[model samples]
Target: MPAPQFDPAAPLQFVVNAAAGSNAAASKREIIESVLQAQGRRGELAFCTPADLARVARVSAQKALSTRTAVVAVGGDGTLNTVAQAAHAAGCAMGVVPQGTFNYFARTHGIPADPAQAVRLLLHSVPAPVQVAGINDRLFLVNASLGLYPDLLEDREAYKARFGRSRWVAFVAACTTLLRAQRQWRLRIETGGTVRDVHTLTLFVGNNRLQLQQLGAEPEDTIAGTPGDGSMAALVLRPIGTLSMIGLMLHGAMGRLGEAAGVERFEFDHLVVRPTLPQGRRGVKVAFDGEVTTMRAPLDFRVLAKPLYLLGPQRSTATAEAVSRAEDAGA
Candidate 1:
């Protein structure tokens, strides 16, 4: 939509996931090579299994920095997140080609799933600033959560493995896991110069507006859209009975979660959460951008000041103006 800000002469480096099928990934690589060759450009491809994902990302990121090229991720949101962490640290422009169960990040940023079409768009794209949030030292592109939420992700993964990877399976697994909720964590949460101690089932943070809206969280009303604006939405679910939990799920399904009872939704520039963990437990389970991991107590979540340069569709001037208007109104 805007004038291209890309270097036509520079090569494109892609980090592809071969876990699903080496032959499939290889076919995509061939397509990418053909596209680039037709344009008289060069492109590099690094195929890696799940175990080799991180190492390949780091190497591709370093190559991106040295060569001043874009590091493209050719997989799902989790793979994109891993490559993004490397590209963000190296301060290189990044691109995406979605290939996951849910391509939340790519879809939010308007990146296509078709490899050739996505690469064609990349050639005409610019390195624009995109907002990124951090939990402790790790960056997350879509959403992050702890407590019952991470357990739900784990359960959903198990369901996906046994049944199949589909929206129905994920939704059923999530509803099942959510209905069985019996655990609650006592937490000290600090935000907006205020602190409170409360028991919550989960503390979920949202960065992408689409997912938040789907969950009936209109955080965009208060959270600024401009990059490095340091605004995010958080949802705190307190301990509730089974009936209330079922109603909460229905509200979320109906896109009215923000109005659901026993759920506290608010916007903040930064948040600090201290969870009470058992003795000798090194870290608490946390899930971000569809992947689960463990982090130590006192998980710090915040809007990162430094923006990640993303190569994709341009943000409309009207959208940018609306963000400014919203920020000013809040001020």
Candidate 2:
């Protein structure tokens, strides 16, 4: 991948999600200030509360776009998504500090999980063009899904609020959702001139190769080989019995989802999915990245030809080594 242009003299604008765990810490602001002061760099930090994140992100993005400043998101995927929407709108380079439950986007881009390290890396990194996927104009850096997956996200959120956010909690929530809502939707999918009807419990469209590998939807060998290809991997889970669904869940938990029966995977530049029944025309629930939203019928999914410039390590041997180390640390 080609490196995005960067100016060392430009100011950095950090949009911190105060709701994020790292930002909730009282010393986070001091840490950021101290780091930049030590580096002799100037930065403006904007704290975004849960109630006004959208507004704060938009204003920050507008400032970045106007001033040609780098806007860094200091939170998880949801925070990144909000800032990304603004950055994309303003046509400015975006950066991220992984401070969320699952920092898939940051991990995929080789960003360190440690907040101080992440900020230091951002200071030295340049903009890199990365592929961005969309479900009806909403941009997502990782993946988007429909049907039972969205329901699972909803259930997971509720469970998270009650039991706390953890891998085990998420797993339990997934089980609860699967057992409680076994309803399947019949969708008519069209991609690359092929039109087919399918009854699926969930459909996932993945843009991040690392996430695809984790889900076992793509072969490990092909994960790093395909980047900025302007294509996405789609995994469709067909309707199955309760026992079989449980088995599928086990396979997914084991990182063998691709080996599970009734799971279909495809790579496409564009796809159109619609419900076979008139009742489905109302709207379809979609989970983009980790945020849930309702999208109208005939959901159009595609990759933007123009990439989003993100502040991250330039793809190189050293970067690869760093990413490997980060992955090992995360594991």
Compose the digit string of candidate 1's lDDT tens values, residues 197-222. Answer: 98999999888765665567665456
Best by TM-score: 2
lDDT of 1: 0.82
How many pairs of residues collide in model 1?
A: 0
The local distance difference test score of each candidate is: 0.82, 0.80
Q: Candidate 2, 203: how far from true, in Å?
A: 0.7
Off by over 4 Å in 1: 1-6, 19-21, 220-229, 317-331
- In angstroms, the error of model 2 at 292 is 0.7
Stretches > 4 Å off in candidate 2: 1-5, 19-25, 219-228, 277-281, 317-331
Q: Give the range where candidate 1 is weakest over 10 consecutive residues by summed lDDT.
A: 321-330
| C-alpha root-mean-square deviation, each candidate | 5.3, 3.1
Clashing residue pairs in candidate 2, if any? 4-127
Clash number by candidate, in order: 0, 1
